[model samples]
Target: MSHTLLSSPLQGFTDFKFRNAFNHFFGGIDTFYAPYIRLNGKMVIKNSYKRDIALENNTELEVIPQIITNDVDEFLFVSKYIRELGYKELNWNLGCPYPMVTKRGMGSGLIHDSKKIDSILHRVHNESDVLVSMKMRMGYENPEEILDTLPILDKYPLKNIAIHARIGKQLYKGGTDLGAFQKCLDNTKHKMYYNGDITSVAAFKELQERFPSIDHWMIGRGLIADPFLPSMIKNNTTEYPKNKIDIFSEFHDRIFKEYDAALSGPTPIRMKMLGFWEYFSQSFENPQKTYKKIKKAKSVKNYTIAVREILKEAKR
Candidate 1:
């Protein structure tokens, strides 16, 4: 059976610039989910989010706009906004585990409130024509929380539910509970897409074997850690290209230059790339040393030199 691979949106990473660069250099993801748009008690869409999903910015990609909100009005407002932009689908984010978001009764925190989930989905469906999809953790406190919520979700015409197997509190720390994921499959009538910890070709194959029924897979940090992973999984190969370092160097430079030009100063760009290197370093020979090299570069000139040296050594 054929499969579909999706890029799961990370808040700070996986924006338009990174998506376009990854698609250009890697070329395996079938679609990309833009990071969730948070309204923050205001109905107005931020300029940054608008640019991220603008048709012109994402012309080469099949992009889906996502929203993180518990309010029906915010959901409807965003749905209308994206619909006017010619988007037919909007993904709801209920998987974020950050304390700031969860504490406010959004993200994974919303998973426990079946009534609220029901009420919001009810209003959105009744008032809007835009298709709705969901990205969720099993529960904020435990795995079974999703079980209660899935029944309510079945009442609506949702596009699909993409589940990240770990509960909210784990916060990407532990192993994905395959057993809990299996329970989700048994309960939901809707199409289920698997997400979490798919970092390599071997890991993907293991997941494919375990969930033969699932066709859609969402790759998050794994895609950033190694941009080549989606294509490798698609080709069913374990080998990197002969010019692996060269390809990666180009990919790295593309996003860096784009971000450098877009960001105002050396500090913002440095912090930005540093956030990415936390994952990108895993692609190198020495993860810790590679990250330290990037982290220590306080100036743009020094940062450029550090990256050049790191990729140079990677070539050898």
Candidate 2:
């Protein structure tokens, strides 16, 4: 299979609308995996998770819906639901490291309990008619701890194993544990895809040189950081990614206009728009100045005014 690059889910950032708009403008990601559906015991999806990946007629990209649960029935419930919607693959989120998720004996927390992992995977695979995939970290508290569970995962017929290389306890704070990742490649019969810290062309190239066997690469924060990493990785064509600051202002205004209408209030809209600026600032000539302008805006009116003024200055 000729593999295509993909965008990993980043909770609030890369939802249905964001993916639709991104693929419309900049062609990079081959397929997107939606944020995990946090289901209750009744095998019913929470409303917010349901909304995050709900397919629209306008959503044109290839998407794999995902689920987060420790229960086999919930896993089966999600897989069946997505399959009926025409998605052939459903990814299981074993990588989320948040305390709340882990505390519930879900996400990476389940990695420690091999018997449960074995039981759940066996039951889900035996029951589900759709393809099952897994996204995971190296381990929960320590990288080597995952080694204990690899034998169990190898028994199941998984579509692919996407490893983030960092332990769950580390969250997104530390560097990838390349040693543990290498161990997975060495031991597991299942095919592998790499994810983590791929924020720039150079970093991606280094990963390519290091592991030429890998066919797919997934980006999370980096996609949001620049919104152009996929194009950069795919075609090496962002050789001249638009440097003019005015264009970013144009992009920001366009997204903000959309968010304001869809979201409930100014606080939510403002927070979302501001989050984009964290990565958007990297596109500026003076990153610090542009970031401050967005960060310091006092009101919704001021935010829009600052955006317009800075965009004008960008033309100078």
Candidate 3:
């Protein structure tokens, strides 16, 4: 079967600017899932969230909007909102493991309550015509939570289910439970996709060998850590471009320029770029030293210097 690769929704990093830039410079991802839109107490969807998933800005890539909400009303609201924006599909986020989200009985936290999952799906599927897919972890606290929830999901005509093989409590640490993922294949008839720890060509190949039938894959931090990873995986080549420095330099500059224009001051822009370096620094040969230099940069000039040094030391 032909394989399709997706860029997993990362709350801060995979915004429209990053999506457009990545597609322009390095094209491999079949679709980009937008970060989950959190509706405020006032029932307002933030303009920034609206702009991020707007079809006008995302003309170059196939994009799917994701929402993190346990409230059926909020789900219906977002569904109507996105459908109005010309989006045909919306992905429900049940994989976020952060405590703030979990404590609200949303994200992976909702996994422990199968009835809530059923209720939300029942209401949304009945009320909205928009196609809904799901992105989730095995469970929030226990590995078996998804087993109970999958049956509930099976009753709905979901577009697909993307499983991140670790339970929510694991966050991004530890190893993915391939054994459990194997069980997932048997439990449900819904089309399934694999997500998590796809950091290298070899890692992806290993998973492909283990689960050859699953042709859909979602990559998150790995894609940020190495912008060339998707292309490298598709081409089946471990070799990165010799001109990686120039290519990355252009990508970095575009993002910086966009953020600088939209954000208020140097500090906000500086903070934004620093967050990216947390994973992006891993792409370098001397990751610790590279990120340390970036962390110490108190000014934009110093930050630029650090970035230039990072490009000079890009892993060959």
Candidate 4:
């Protein structure tokens, strides 16, 4: 059976620059979800969010805009804003597990509050025509939280629900609960897409065999760890392209140059690239050393040299 692969949105990593560069270089993800738009107690959409979903910025890809909020008004506001931008769908993020967000009764924390989920979906469906979908963890504190919320979600016509298979408190630390995920499959009437720990072709194959009913798969950190993953999965191959190092080097330089131009100073760019290397290092033979090499580069010149040496060594 064929599969539809989606690039799951990561807060700071999968921006327009990275998306475009990844699409150009890797070429497997069927769609990309822009990181959640947070209103921050204001009804305003940040310029950064605007730039991310701007049609011009994402012309080459099928992109979906996502919003992280518990406010109905904020949901409507962002929905209208994106509608005006010619986007027809908005993905609601209820999967974020960060303490700061969950403490406020948003993201995964909202799962336990079925009434609020019902109310918010109620108002949004009544007031807006924008198609809705969801990204969620099974629960914040426990897997059963989503079971209570799932019935409320069934009332609305959500496009689909992508589940990460772990609860909020786990915060990507423990293994995904396949048994809980199976329970989710049995409970919900909505189309369910699977997301979590799909890091390699072998891992993806394991999931495909485990859940033959699911055709849509969302890849989060796995894509960043190895951009080649999605395409390799699509081709049904375990081997990478012969020029993996050269391709990765070019892909890295593209994002680095683009981000370097977009961000103001060396410190910001360094920190940004460093954040990415936390995942990118996993692609190298020596993950810790590769990350340490990037982390130790205090100057931009030194960072460039470090990357060059890493890639050259990778080729050999």
Clashes of 3: 0
Give the worst 10-residue stretch by lDDT in candidate 1.
244-253
Quote the lDDT for 244 in model 2.
36
Please report how far candidate 4 places residue 290 from its true position, in Å: 0.7
> What is the C-alpha local distance difference test score of candidate 1?
0.96
Give per-model TM-scores: 0.99, 0.92, 0.98, 0.99
Model 2 has an lDDT value of: 0.81
Question: What TM-score does structure 1 among the candidates reach?
Answer: 0.99
Question: Which whole-number lDDT from 0 to 100 does residue 310 have in model 4?
Answer: 95
Over the stretch 1-316, how does candidate 3's per-residue lDDT look in tens digits? 6789999999989999999999999888999999999985447999999899888899889999999998989999999999998899999999999999998998999988999899899999999999999999989888799999999999999999999999888899899999999888889999999998999999999999999999999999999999999999888899988888799899999999999999998899999999999998898887889889999999999999988877776634
Candidate 1 per-residue lDDT over residues 1-316, each given as its tens digit: 8999999999999999999999999999999999999999898999999999999999999999999999999999999999999999999999999999999999999999999999999989999999999999999999999999999999999999999999999999989999999999999899999999999999999999999999999999999999899999999999999999899889989999999999998999999999999999999999999999999899999999999999999988
Worst 10 residues of 3 by lDDT: 307-316
Q: On a 0 to 100 scale, what is the lDDT of residue 309 in model 1?
A: 98
Give the candidate order by descending lDDT. 1, 4, 3, 2
Question: What clash pairs does model 2 have?
Answer: none
Runs in model 2 deviating more than 4 A are 1-3, 242-250, 310-316
Q: What local lDDT does model 2 show for residue 193?
A: 92
